[model samples]
Target chain A: MSESLVSRIKPVLGLDNKWWWDQAAEGVLAIQRCQGCQSLRHPPRPMCDQCQSQEWDFISASGKGTVCSFTVLHHPKFPGYDYPLIIVLVELAEGTRITSQLTGCEPDEVDFDMPVEMVMQRDADGFQLPYFRPSQ
Target chain B: MTINVSGEAAIAGVANTEFSKNSGVSELELASVAVRDAIADAGLKPSDVDGMTTFTLDNTDEIEIARAVGIGDLTFYSRVPHGGGAATGLVHQAVMAVATGMAEVVVCYRALNGRSGHRYSSGVAGPLLTSDAIHWGWYTPYGLMTPASWVAMYTQRYMHLAENVQDAMFEIAHVQRQYAAKNPAAFFYQRPFDRADYDASRPIVSPFKMLDCCMETDGGSAVVVTTAERAKDLKHPAVIVKGVAQAAAADMESMTSFYRPEIARIPSMDIAAKMAYEQSGLCADDIDAAVIYDAFTPIVLWQLESWGFCDLLEAPKFVLDGALRSDGRLPTNTHGGQLSEAYIHGVNGVVEATRLVRGQSVNQPAKEVNNVLVTSGVGVPTGGALLGRSD
Candidate 1:
């Protein structure tokens, strides 16, 4: 199937979210950093909630974080994902959190506060998404 | 300062349509049935209902139900959002309306084919752009799509903090199922499970076995609200709306609120609980029965902690101590809760609260049940209420 017509769900491409996706596709995990307050945010927003600044810039994070929380989904399988899929809330070193899939480990192997590093994982259609893995 | 409307409005009637996995009828019909029954339970004609309210998530609107039920000339109408969290807030709106004379008789109802139609457990299929959808867009593609997955994120963190997370979760399921065994209306009706069964159930999301999840039931529940004085002339003894509150913290998100500093704490619940106590002038110790929302078992413990019935880290010990039994410290969900009973959102919980207050609960407590605390959905903007007997 063509990348654009793979029948796999993809993030809604919009003015606020397109930049992050474009950056992630290039193998860099970028987050919105507010120009007014330097506050970093994930799942990009139109305005910096803290400083109310519509002005922002993207910063490529260090790709390192700790698992603040996680869940292993085992039922009602969806397309483009495996069963017992590990989803994690990673608190980035820069002090913001993002929800992403965690690969390279068993469901029981992931623990809270475990150090992880972000890596680019793509959907069947070739859209890259940020996923995390345990750091040695 | 929050205006305390305690004892101003009373729940004169509470009724529900048959509980089922599939009602085989439209949500509108279910709403009409539940509303008509609730009004009759209050010993009032449909014409007496001049106002109506319900949750925004409910497919059946007040006007539609009003039209079908023959309720005329609504002086007040409103809808509270936040999914099941608005269950008790429906009472809050109705009470506020009746207390201020905006409406004399108000009916609160929620109807949906949650199972047969839009199953919440079945994750959203989307690329939608509603504000809520925007939040889901962030993680749904990453396989964090369903409500179970979102709650599991924090529940896993909760497990790390608690001494016996798995055992505690299983015990909650076991206790509620035991209650369900006695209540014929429960989805699990006579199918009680042991701890072994809970442990062996299929895992939907980590830290959440199949037993921990509430059945997505298709049904409707409705309650009637009126001035406390008028309730004295009603069919059943009045269940006073002592206090009602809806609260959300600064960082509160719909369901995935992991971005906050403390993902384990349900701040919205704590806020609502605090307001319930303050407005009602009653503490956790005064509550005789509680109908804590149990869409997921872990949430029951989360709410017990948030409501200050026990310390945040003491819920497991609290549960193991038999605190949820009919003769225990806080006999909870005497009607089996959403975990075992029908998941009519949390409105069924509200109805159970009225039953306990009226001494009509199937699993009535050993002691006199006076004040019953009914909490709505957690993991989102939540609401809480304190219902009590007038004397």
Candidate 2:
């Protein structure tokens, strides 16, 4: 997992979101949860929509999920990523979704509701990020 | 208490600079010219315009547009965010201004050098400076940054369950182009393509072909809104703002509302449709024509279904059955659309809806168009409005 297959873009980390990337780097997939209302949120937010609680914590999710949806991009030919890139939305077993690239599969080989598991990879800048691979 | 300002304000004027690849001028100049023309089209002096609304994405400020158009002061001025989704929101802002006696004549305008300057499709490459960048950060690392890619997340899921969507997507583009063939202001005017051209077009993002994407043209479009009573004395027939709703659904991310329970549905548009129907007291059956935002072909199907013009997974079938043709049940995008007309960020759509209600569209439907539904961007916080004649 140290040697990179291809360099990737680094995320613009923020106070609340930085924690998720930090957790992914430590071999753990973390999801945010509101302490007061016990509600879970993705892409991490400061407050809870259910109870207006600014207080929250995280849950270590099982890295197993299913690809709910995906896209194969060809144009804009962005640097650091291969063409016909397949990015997927994986619905985690704990009932929340996470966005990441689907690795180890061709764009044509991917299908809806496919089973996938998370993998940690380091970009060119040594920034660790999460990716999804098809379940064996 | 709900603000039922429905039927109180009307759109009295609609104008647009020609759609082209290069305007050879600044966006500020385009806004001034379009605004000036819209004021004249409303048959009102510049001094009479006291309010203004434009997209936050627009380069020109209201004071700058006001100064350039020779207007003195403004009692109410605002900008709606969310890019193209702000089209009908501009109308909402204008109607509210006139409704509360804040401003007499409010102009909603959008001008951009999308082709000649910064093409929007290219902005997704990297490093979006907006505050929303925080939300996009999670996706960009995986190269899921562009609007097409973001929308594909939903479209891929949609096509998975639907039938004949590929054919329907092409037919929507072709049908809009058919309407564009008759519009001199359209980018594709005098140029109509057949099924062969569609098959030949390359797919940019798997489901979306090159021809399916909207035109990135350099142009400007503006509309004038005023009180229903004052609009009656204008040069042209007044198209009353019978219903307008701006909806920012929960858990919405700019274009990447992928975390929603139903990945294929546009909750914002559904919310806007419900609010609009409640405000106007008009059902989908009352709509005679429409200008559904065509940023991409799939968007038309989404809006049509969201606005209740058709059922879920039924939009493609609706298009395949010729529901959008001039002689079809509901004539749509008679001035073309963002696809064939121009991408003024859906503001041109509001202008065209005004034309349909005023009975002045170039390719007017054979059936009389009174309640014309106009919508802004989807997959984001969006808006929609129903326009019809006060008479």
Question: Global lDDT of each model?
Answer: 0.86, 0.86
The parts of candidate 1 lying over 4 Å away from their true place are: A1-136, B127-129
lDDT of 1 at B4: 68
| Candidate 1 structure, TM-score to reference | 0.73
lDDT of 2 by residue, B137-239 (tens): 8887788877877887788999998888889888889999999999998999999999899888887887888888898999999999999999999999899
lDDT of 1: 0.86
Task: Name the weakest run of 10 consecutive residues (lDDT summed) in model 1 chain A.
Answer: A1-10
DockQ of 1: 0.01
Model 2 interface DockQ: 0.01
Error of 2 at B69 (Å): 1.5
Candidate 2 docking class: incorrect
Q: Stretches of candidate 2 above 4 Å error?
A: A1-136
What's the true lDDT of residue A126 in model 1?
Answer: 72
TM-score of each: 0.73, 0.74
